[model samples]
Target: MKRINRLYIKSIFSALVISLLSCSDDFLTKEPKGVVVADLLNTPKGVDNLLIGAYSLLDGAGSSNGFPSYAYPASIRNWVWDCASDDAYKGTTLGDFATGGEVERYEALPTNQLIEQKWYVMYDGVSRANDVLKALAKAKVNMSEANVNVLSAQARFLRGFFHFRLQQMHFQIPYITEDVADPALVKNDHPVWDEVETDLQFAIDNLPESFPGEPGRATKWAAMAAKAHVHLFQKEFPAAKILLDAIIASGKFALVDNFRDNYTASTENNKESVFEIQSAVNDGTSQGFNGNPDSWTTNPYNRFLPTCCGMYQPSQDLVNAFKVDKDGLPLLGIGGPKYNDTNLKNDMGINSADNFVPDTHLLDPRLDWTVGRRGIPYLDWGINTGNEWVRDQVNGGPYIPIKQMFTKAAQKDASHTTFARATAINYRLYRYAHILLWRAECAIEENDLPKAMQLINQVRKRASDDFVMGKVNTYAFPSSVTIDVDYTKPAANYLLGEYKTFPSQAYAREALQMELRLETAMEGNRFFDLVRWEKDAEVLTKFVENDSKFRVFMKGAQYKKGVNDHWPIPQSQIDIQKGVLIQDPAF
Candidate 1:
């Protein structure tokens, strides 16, 4: 199967209609003068159109819908919630997205507007999935059984995916379906994990291993990955292990040669992707949201996007996470979450004019790729002007994000949209590396320490040897975002190490945890991973206490797990349900 060539205009045009279709809408009911609407839609084309509409919302790029433009906070990147992770800050200013600041500080409340918007976007996705199923049911077209099976499977897979996203945020949520007559009366009294698993299993059992020409469509492997994730989230170790074993054994996917490939537009939807959210730019005449507009605010100011928004700043403590020992293994054990080494400081306290020597620690090569720090080469954007790119020093910190960015060479793929900063760089919802690490997690859970160690090393070896982002010399305009640059002079004193052994299950677990953080850090999985491991309260509370000196917004922030562990059911949703929706008791 072809991994990626480039997303053509046809695929993009059909996949971005979710922004136009309202959540309350079924199939478009109205017809022009003589055409019967249902007759046109009761064919294979109609079913496919609804399916495409379902695919469109995967980006959650949001809609205008008669209001002044607003990118609802449901980006598939999960950056809004991802910022709450210890590794990132809501970086621009405390006043901007103050609710996001509350989320970061662990003072999250049910009334938070962003939380409400996230609820709306996720439900909108679920409704879109239902739209596909509803259309398929009334189809008068003479279609093969295989076609029916694939169509239903893809829709349920998406339904499971969207509901799973919501359940991860609010533990108690209603599992809405096309069968439900009155959604507002639906209750959130029980867990939706079982329903989510069933939907995914149906998809897994029915979907083909690959869709051949359509790389964006969900496949059996995608369903399997989603099912395994659902199992892992519920701590169903044996169940998750079975699915993961199948996926790894299939030999359908593997890590790409370069880490930059995972983020760059030109290399998107590559072999690394198990499931990737596809985004694309139009030639200025598309009717719906073209690419990922919701992700625009995360871009840096002055240096890149015209907007002053630079939220999702890398934390100083996160930079410390990249430090490796003489053997190249992460020194995460040196200190707890916040291992403050003055040597790793990227001009934090010093004046720009002062003659300062760079603190070159033996670091993980992934650091510069994941974060854009002072003097560090930021893609082809030349050496990053770190402090100058920062919107707020005291709260946002010195580091800028780099992983969400596309290389300068692919700007047309990333930038040519109505939202000038809108990017076509696909978000890898699940990649081959994710399954490899999860397999290691399963190994650790099974107490097969050596197997866990081996799997962890498998992932580590890739980071140690991949062709990393090298430097170019132009300062005015980014000369190169290419990894093929002069590696004779590297971007940092980078050294990566592999684990020799795992002495105990605890040690194996810690190693896996640290590796997961280092591997997927800014991609937005840290905070939730901690929650999944039942370590949020313990880990995040400690992170705040230690890193508060570096980030003033966290100075006295207290983290109590109730509301912090899971977001409460949105107040507006509960009101609409007319007291039927039971809020998360965790709150």
Candidate 2:
């Protein structure tokens, strides 16, 4: 339970592998280096170090195969998920990350390298987790049986976590475990939910409720939360509710007073964090071809910022989704007066340097926190000058991502300088707010409208605290003009209110769905949530139809009902297994 330095652990891992290489024979032609490393991993310290390596993969980088060309597939941020949904556009030009553009347009094929690379990185995580189990079983260490159980449980949890991510992307993926001696012979013909659930259950039963010293390591609460997430996706409401209720009663977590704190580095591993990926910089490691030699660094700053490639632009629809009524409730759908109407206002056609006014109308405070629109404070960075921050406003729109970008003051301590931008910001995988919303969904499915409304209101009330504005420090443009103002002032007519009641089950469900979209926005769960609720077709079809009007890139995008629900099994993977892996139906 000690605060284990990830950099120190990685150093040990590197040194051990380096020590195994002799001057005589090439280690590549002989037994795999992992086999040699596993032989030395017989002591308790060695087993724990191996477990650390498994944890390192949480960043979705650091593979021995070298970094993936684009950070989308490898980074835990999963920008592709946001792009695939209505929440965001594949920013930049058409030719940049062309395969990703195909995904955004719903034209993805089995041969898309983006999909294939994602499959490779996730499977590599599975293989690494399995390696820990293989080594643990063979170890001759004189550790207590309880200690071994905990280690084995941690390894199984990681294996399940990696497989679960694959399952979300490719529903019928192969669930590789320690039993599988050869992964190439495995088949992706069956649903891995059963295996994933089983592994998570073991982890839930074995992991400690809290690890005070090691904040980022998975705990019993995290395992339970992850298992419940799987159940929610599978529509097992009763099952999910039980775990969620326990987490809520455990008093282990609570939403931070300021929602923006969840995204900042200075306040990481706060009370709201249930499980977060650990990232560190300036740890004395040299920056590699991509960024830091350590694959844990995030590259969103490279692409999402306007000063850079300006990829992952927030969609106009998403910006409009934040519009609230006079009473602070969301004006839902395109039928609403404010919906998709220019009255809501944006920088779509305006130049950044030209003097223009931002739409200071009724809006959700979270909108400014989530999207860096023109004229608003962008977390200690200068006021977002629309076109100046945008690479090509004509193609990508005029908004840049804000949640993951580091503040200028914290950049030295939080990010790495490279050919592209990279940062040490930890990607929050599970948080208490997500738990609240998932529980609310379960309540709605169980016909507990009052309970659902109450839970939903709790989330809203926290968001409506109105203290977030004070937490943000505004900066002047041109590095000269010193115009001081109250940070508490509404950025853009910010108005968000709690739900009073729900007249019908349908109404409650609709409100719950919209709340999730508004709350999470661009954190990469929109597409998956829609799929889980079986509302992908209804939601995305309308989103594409409406969004295409403004975003020319989405002109031909279509969300096929059943086929698009799950991505196709990579053609190369099926070919590698020689038909052992069956493609999803209709692929």
Candidate 3:
């Protein structure tokens, strides 16, 4: 959405690199070199630069070492969250990312290195945000009180955002601020929801409706939307509804005409994007893996690219959840017959060389947009070739991720090839469609079935209208074969329609839940949604049971309620902090 200034971004990167190179216990505490560095930070220019540094952490890249690793816990893509949920599988071949496999199988221990890495990265973000506020507090340059307030508001917003992420993953976390002189002394034992709300509210009050030159920066609407999301997760329906209604009345956002556009680089930061993590490629940084100072790159291409490691495959249960009846409605009956028995076409047990066709039965139009199935044109990368494209189909199944990838046409400007496929595809943390579904959930919980149904149908209508594929001239295979296919043809027996009315509140509740799962299938929200609904055990237990039948790797998987509700506080963190952080139950 915003063409981030290369010079400005590079300056921020340079500062971060210098701080990292010093090898201090805390990078934020690094002393400024001289008048140039100190004067720059004390003036208005310094405040802006510091703000950019705080924003840079949104990508979850906390190092200047350049190598893209899954160890970065704060990755906006939510790879770990997706794998832990029933919507996806740890698609990489066995013996690769074994720690990730443990997470996938519900066997993660405090010793899991990935968990520790993530804990550090998220706190790193919190620390950066606090540094911005601390810098502003002691600035020697002349600045208006209003300007200072705005900067503080933005910094606090980020602080709250990072803390909220920790709470979501770990359930209990210490809320750090600029006032904290020594973070090591903080305890991860208390709830920080009140502090989070205060920070977000400050942002909502101070942020402008839009930043003209900085499109991806947080805005008033972003703050409100994020706070609303927090309330929804906390089951504060009425409180969340007030914020959602205000957002709708603001008239600053709406769903784009095409659902696929929300995922592609060609149409990022459109009308629907509420808050997006900005990424950049080939930005004149020679640092290679570590040198790109702006934290504006991602490794989804490397992981999701069929030819690469092929991690994060969509699950068959997720695919089957997309099935619709003749009337274009989800086949509804919770705790009833599993939908996988409906003869839905799948590529399990079938090889890439085998003659197979995608299920042509009536289905939701959003399925093709959310998943890369066999025989479907996977953007410009050609038809998905089953096992050939998958790293291990028997373990992870056939589907590859689609929503987070960039197209070949857009890759020139949006992607870079280092050790992995790093691209500038912004990870959308909040979008209009997400807001609609969340508001629907609020309404449903409040017993406002009529209002909930209307909101749900609004989202469904958008998916139905945005189902058409883009124009493609020719499809090429990785093995040097090319073929022509009608780009306008539907990839499956696609059919979807708006509900005339909800049969009852129970039916409406089920429909609303299904809508959330389908609308935000693999963007890392599923497991959390299950937890929020208090249905994690029921849904995931059924998911493991049904999916394990075909996906052998998941045979022993189980979801123990209360225990699996939150990941154990990383054991490494506990030992390092000398028991400042207590482990959650059933660890």
Candidate 4:
């Protein structure tokens, strides 16, 4: 809840730009002397300037203003709900929305718009890194070999990072490392996954072990973490484990003790984060504009504005994933009877509770960390949610009347209620807990139940007040309880659900999945996690049926459609590419 915008202090682009421009008067001069081509372009300072220019892409109107970035596709598109629904991401059109829906053939026109944006942004990054790499090859700047290697490594890491995002989305994209021979030609070479792997491998091997005392700059650990993720995507489990373990053992990072710390603006640059997009709110008119997606999605006023886009919202599917307790327990069977608290309100406003279910707090720590309910004490909560009241949107649902969730304090200033205030929580891109889950996934794949259990318990150990731990006594259903829609099934029989203990492993897996569902939910991990685990079919089926916890809490009015799964690439891209680019199959 603390405002830590002050912690964002590193800005290498500015320094590089200044350094490059100061090299020679010819650098900024319009005409070359005596018609001779300027030598400044090839100079060390000029090369540095080029690198700065590459980084400048990150600050372009599309990205810096929070308009178009891979972050949108990567973090928001597929994750608004467990599986997309017309009510959510319109993912039902993707055929994976878990409900039976018509397949939406990719309309080249709309899909291309987003594709082009992501494509160009990533390539822009690659082009810049390539410039740095090329400069290092030829520049005669008098610097320590160590410094040169460090800088070069950072560049390669960035290049690899951009490529990784591109490859994941488009599956195939041109891997242009240098300025192409013809600037007019947008390179059309789409490399296979192997080639993408090769590029990332180079980054892993050559990157420096750490940044030069700066957090955002690429480091050896960042490269390794990226490599681990890439390897996982390729199903190279051993190599993935090796890379992940290397990063973990380096002792450079760990999970923050307070779960909420990872999301608070004040803790933006905390040690637990392995890597994160460095966002800083410019001073002056933009008092708190740090370029975070949270400012857009989670802020009260931003979402209400017609012009401001509503990228994502916590789906009832995800909101239901948290276990009532933390001791690695399941909630479905042991989760007990769902309870509704009419008085409950989100940090958003008074009627916010209309879309929320109170028993969600049965999950204890995870819920407290994920969403802000009525009573939690946050000084900033006072600033944002206090005494604010606003009309709630009709959420396009029939089961519940949409309610506005906020306090009188939040609604006072229309500007403060909007994203203009920077009240949204910053997402943690990488955390130590994910490492534990990663290891567990590997163990599960290997069928090493004991190892998987060990890692899971480690996470549980840290989450002291979670459901399985029995710390949350408020909603603890009696051991003899069972819930069945049939009404004929005895509550005791349902509670036992063929398990003797309250939160059994059968229930625990459900619990862990729910924990993951809630823990990483809107942050962008859900869709990918489902696909990677190949659990989409079954999980989404439940999602569409409105049987998932999120829907259950809302009394099951949401209809899941399959098309909601995959997003249609923006249409504008196809129009620009004409016949050059192809659209994704089934959109």
**TM-score list, all predictions:** 0.89, 0.90, 0.90, 0.67
- The CA lDDT of each predicted structure is 0.73, 0.72, 0.72, 0.44
Model 2 scores a C-alpha lDDT of 0.72
Tell me the spans in candidate 4 whose CA falls farther than 4 Å from its real position.
1-116, 140-145, 179-191, 282-290, 302-311, 325-328, 332-361, 373-393, 396-420, 423-427, 466-515, 547-580
Question: Which candidate number maximizes TM-score?
Answer: 3
Candidate 2 — which residues are off by over 4 angstroms?
A: 1-5, 8-12, 15-36, 68-70, 288-307, 333-338, 341-343, 417-420, 467-488
> Candidate 4: minimum summed lDDT over ten consecutive residues — where?
490-499
lDDT of 2 by residue, 1-118 (tens): 1133344334666445423321111101112456556567756777776677666666656554445453466556677766888788777776777887887888899999878877
For 283-380, candidate 3 gives per-residue lDDT tens digits of 66543222222222222223335234567778888888888877888887654544566547777777665656555577898888888777777877
Residues 1-587 of candidate 4 have per-residue lDDT tens digits of 11222222134543333233321211111122422212444455555555554443432212322343334433322232222421232221122221211111112233333444455455556665676666566564666666566656666666676666666555345555554553223433454456556656766666666555445555566666777777767667787778777776788777676655665555666767776554444332243344453343332332223212222333434434443333334455444632121212233322432322223333434543443323232223321121121122222111110111222343333123333533333345566777766766665556665666676666655555321111111221222433112222211111111112323444445544554554564455665566555565555555555533332222333323333334443455445555655555555
Clashes (backbone N, CA, C under 3 Å), per candidate, total: 3, 2, 5, 63
Off by over 4 Å in 1: 1-21, 24-39, 62-72, 285-288, 304-308, 334-343, 349-351, 417-419, 467-487
TM-score, cand. 3 vs. native: 0.90
Q: Residue 93 CA error for candidate 4 (Å)?
A: 20
Candidate with the greatest lDDT versus the true structure: 1
125, model 4: CA deviation in Å? Answer: 2.6
- What would the TM-score be for candidate 4 when compared with the true structure? 0.67
